[model samples]
Target: MKNIIITGTSRGIGYELAWQFADAGHNVLAISRKTPQTLLGNKNITCLSVDLSDETEMEKVDNFLSHSWKTVDIIIHNAGSLLLKPFSETSQEDFENIYKVNVFGVANLTRACLPYLQKGSHVVTISSMGGIQGSLKFAGLAAYSSSKGAVITLSELLAEEYKEKGVSFNVLALGAVQTEMLQEAFPGYEAPITAKEMADYIFDFALTGNKYYNGKVLQVSSTNP
Candidate 1:
């Protein structure tokens, strides 16, 4: 069984992904700020209540890997911080806070796991369609969209840096999904996709997409919104 690490497992797509990976007979490390009770008794899963933006908290992942895992097969950077506010009303702190989780946290966490990532390992980052340049843009997402875009670029760079080593890095720019984060960004609007549905796609991609592509961003959207 492959050893996989997933972030943002407290709810939405990450929550569903944790259980799905475990059910598939993989060893899963589920990390989020709040641990989910659903993962409590699973033998295939290890749940960690962690703050991604905190450097100290992320070190625990390294510790766990050193103690129990042979090597990491996959890492899904699913933890995200969303801030929806009009540009004029958004404060500097609000913007920085979003970057802390969406950008800095991604960099720090990836760096921490690199020692355990060998050839054939995949690093999949979950981005948003809003982050894509020239894609549809929405108001009230200045901080959120910008941060997502940064991560997309980050993944591409990592893929380039690790090409010789055969590690793969890719980004999935997802469209509107009916998630709590979506509700915060746009209330009263139903999305074409559900959290579990999106998780299903990610699960498959995390497992095998690296064989076909690496250092690329796949736009996983069927709708404009």
Candidate 2:
């Protein structure tokens, strides 16, 4: 079984992803701002409290993982922040906070874990379709969209850099899924995909050991018609 680390595991997609990995019999290191509600009885899962907003906490996580695991087979940079405010009205503080978690926080965690990542290990980042297309259809998401765009770029760069090292990077560029984050920004909105379903697909993709998927952004949505 693979030793996997996933961030933002308190709820929604993160929560679902943790459960999926654990059920697959992999050792999971789940990280989040608070202990997750879903990992209550899973022995395969280890939940670590980490506020990605705090760089110090992320550093602690880095150190902990480096000391504990000989190597990580998978690292999922899934914790993210979104500020649903118009660009014109977005406060400076919110912008900074968004970038802090979405951009800088991701970078720090990846850098910290790089040393422990071995050949054939995979790095997955949860990006958004917004990162590819600047669809203003969703109002007040400039900060969020811009940050996701940065992630797309980061994934590309890592794919090229890690190719020779036998590491792979894939960005799951997801469409709207039903999650608390979604409801918070778009109340009563209906989405075609659910978080649990998306999590299942991601787990499957990661295990395929297919190098062709490397450095590519895979978009997912409900296959339900």
> Which prediction has the highest TM-score against the true structure?
1
Per residue, candidate 1 scores C-alpha lDDT tens digits across 70-100 of 5999999999989878899999999989998
What stretches of model 2 exceed 4 Å from their correct place?
37-40, 134-137, 222-225
Model 2: residue 10 alpha-carbon error in angstroms? 0.5
Best by lDDT: 1
Alpha-carbon deviation at 112 in model 1, angstroms: 0.3
Candidate 2: tens digits of C-alpha lDDT, residues 74-128 = 9888888988887889988988899989988788888878888888999889888
lDDT against true structure, model 2: 0.83
Clashing pairs in 2: none
Worst 10 residues of 1 by lDDT: 178-187
Q: At residue 125, what lDDT does model 2 achieve?
A: 90
Residue 133 displacement in candidate 1 (angstroms): 0.5
